[model samples]
Target chain A: QKEVEQDPGPLSVPEGAIVSLNCTYSNSAFQYFMWYRQYSRKGPELLMYTYSSGNKEDGRFTAQVDKSSKYISLFIRDSQPSDSATYLCAMTQRRAGTASKLTFGTGTRLQVTL
Target chain B: NAGVTQTPKFRVLKTGQSMTLLCAQDMNHEYMYWYRQDPGMGLRLIHYSVGEGTTAKGEVPDGYNVSRLKKQNFLLGLESAAPSQTSVYFCASSYLAGGPFGRGTGELFFGEGSRLTVL
Candidate 1:
């Protein structure tokens, strides 16, 4: 099984709708969770990041992590056409004296239409 | 600053032909990584360097080699290109891990990307 699993969704929604993207993982050691946005022909950029099992809010986006269930989610409120892109979930374990390496999910493609 | 820059934005390679993809970072980060993105495969790490002169293999490292002789540059080499190797390559960099809480989250800054097609 892959370390991280996410629904490869080409999910389309109307503008101003609420969007939720999620991912599940088997590695309990993962402590740092992150969300990344990738547009067509572009590299993925860090969107939101959370440590351990908790929720972090930034602007219109909220990231939630449940360590017990090994599940994480990203919620977008009042979505816009400019927000259309692929969302990927990545996680890594924190190790002292070593650089953390992230393991990413397959990513969910989201499109917001007017 | 140009956080990370990849050379040869696009390239076409014949089977068995060899080429090197260059990645330069102006952030002076200690950790550098190379990843390939393909349909349904998100991003798979090819190789990474924790520091200059040190390289380690990631999930997908076969048919590819890497060198990090300098602190600011990381190079990915395909000794014998294959059709299966065609994909968009990305380079990323980050500061050292494990600082104060939420201080160093290992948030990576990525380059635009290098699209390679193997014929």
Candidate 2:
């Protein structure tokens, strides 16, 4: 099984709707959780980052991590049409001072319509 | 300054052809990585560098080689490309500062990505 699993969603929602995206991981050693937003034909950009567990709020996005459950989530409040994009969840375990290898989910594609 | 820049935004090559994708970062980051994104497969790491003159293989390093002779530059070379190697390639850098240096403590600045197709 893949280390990380996310719903490959083409979930369509109206503007101003609340959108919740989630991913479940199997690796207990994965301590860093991240959410990335990728636009069409563009590189994935970091949207939210959480180390270990707990919730972090930034603007309209909220990222939550549960180490015990090996689950992570990104919540978008008052979603807009411009928010349409693919959201990816990534996890990693550190390796000294080097960059840890990141394991990513297939990504969840969301479409917010006006 | 451009956070991260990748050369040859797009390219096409026949099977068995060779090419090198260049990545340059101006952020003075110590960590750099190369990844390829394919449909449903997500992003797979090709190689990574922690500092100048140091490199390590990643999840998908076979059929590929990398060089980090310069701190600001990381190159991914395909000795002989195959149909399976066609994908969008991205280079990313991270600045790890403060904190306890946890598992995921830094933000990765990524390039625009290079799309290559093996015909």
Candidate 3:
């Protein structure tokens, strides 16, 4: 089984709608979850990050992690056309001195239309 | 700062040809990584460096090799390319600050990808 799985959604929604993106993982050791946004021809930028199981909010974006369920989510409120991008979910386990390695999901493409 | 920058934004390589992709970061970060994004496969790690003069294999490292001779640069080399190696390659860097609680080691700053087509 793939370590991390996410729906490759070309999910389209109207402007002002709420958008939710999610991912599930098989590794319970993963302690950090992150969301990255990538626009066409651009690199993936860090959107939101969370440690362990909890929720972190940043403006219109919210990231939630449930370690028990091995699930994580990113919620976007009042979506706009500018919000159209591929959202990638990534997870990492905390290790000593060495930096953690990341495992990424098949990005979900989101389109917020006018 | 340019953050992380990748060279040769696009390239076409004939099968068995060798090429090197360069990634330079001005952030002085200790950790650098190379990942390839394929259609439906997401971004899979090719190789990574924890510090200068150090390299480690990642999930997909078979057709690729990497080197980190400088703290600010990491290079991924394709020794004899294959059609299966065609993908968008990205390089990222992150710093270790205040242990692991403040932010992830993978709080990556990415570069504009290098798209390689191995024909």
Candidate 4:
């Protein structure tokens, strides 16, 4: 099994709808969880980051991590067409000083239609 | 200010041909990384550097080599290109900073990307 698993969803939603993307991992040592957004022909950009397990809110985006279940999620409120992109879930083993390499999931493609 | 920039946005090469992808970051970050993104495979690390003059192999280092002689640049080289080496290459950098209540943390800033196709 892959270290991280995410559904490669071409999920389409109407404007203003709430969208949820999820990922599951088997590694218990992954402490740093992150969500990245990649537009067509562009590099992945960091959207949300969380340490260990907890919930973090930023604008219309909320990221939740459940360490016990090895699950992580990103929720988008009042989605818009501008939010359409590939959402990638990534995580790394916690270490001191510098950050370690990230293991990523097969990103879920989101299309928020107007 | 260009956060991160990659050279040769697109390239195509035949088998046995060699090429180098260059990455430059002006953020003066201490950590830089090279990754390749492929469909269904997500992003795989090729190599990384913690600081100037230091380099280390990543998860997918085979058929590739890297050098970080300068602080602002990291290069990924394919000595003898293979069809399997074709992918979108990305460069990212991060610096240790105080995050969320004085905690030492960091986040990656990525370049646009370099698409290379090896035939």
Docking class of 1: medium
Model 2 Cα lDDT, one tens digit per residue, A1-114: 999999998999999999999999999998788999999988889898888899999999999999998889999999999999999999888654657578899999999999
lDDT of 4 by residue, A43-83 (tens): 88989999999999999999999999999999999999999
Clashing pairs in 4: none
Error of 2 at A21 (Å): 0.1
Off by over 4 Å in 1: B98-102
lDDT of 3 by residue, A1-114 (tens): 899999998999999999999999999999889999999989999898888999999999999999999999999999999999999999988675666588999999999999
Collision count for each candidate, in order: 0, 0, 0, 0
The DockQ values of the predictions, listed in order, are 0.76, 0.64, 0.69, 0.67
Candidate 1 clash pair list: none
Angstrom error of the Cα, residue A8, model 1: value is 1.1
For candidate 1 chain B, the 10 contiguous residues with the lowest summed lDDT are B97-106
Candidate 3, residue A56: how far the Cα is off, in Å: 1.3
TM-score to native of every candidate shown: 0.97, 0.95, 0.96, 0.96
Worst 10 residues of 2 chain A by lDDT: A93-102
lDDT of each: 0.93, 0.91, 0.91, 0.92
How would you encode candidate 1's per-residue C-alpha lDDT over A1-114 as one tens digit per residue?
Answer: 889999998999999999999999999999899999999878899999998999999999999999999999999999999999999999988686676689999999999999
- How high is the TM-score of chain A in model 3? 0.97
Comparing chain B with the reference, what is the TM-score for each candidate? 0.96, 0.93, 0.94, 0.93
Between candidates 1 and 3, which one is better according to DockQ?
Answer: 1
Which runs of model 3 end up more than 4 angstroms from their true locations? B97-105
Top lDDT: which candidate number? 1
lDDT over C-alpha atoms for residue B7 of model 4: 98
Residues B1-119 of candidate 3 have per-residue lDDT tens digits of 78899999999999999999999999888899999999899998889988999999998999899999989989999999999999999999888744445553448889999999999
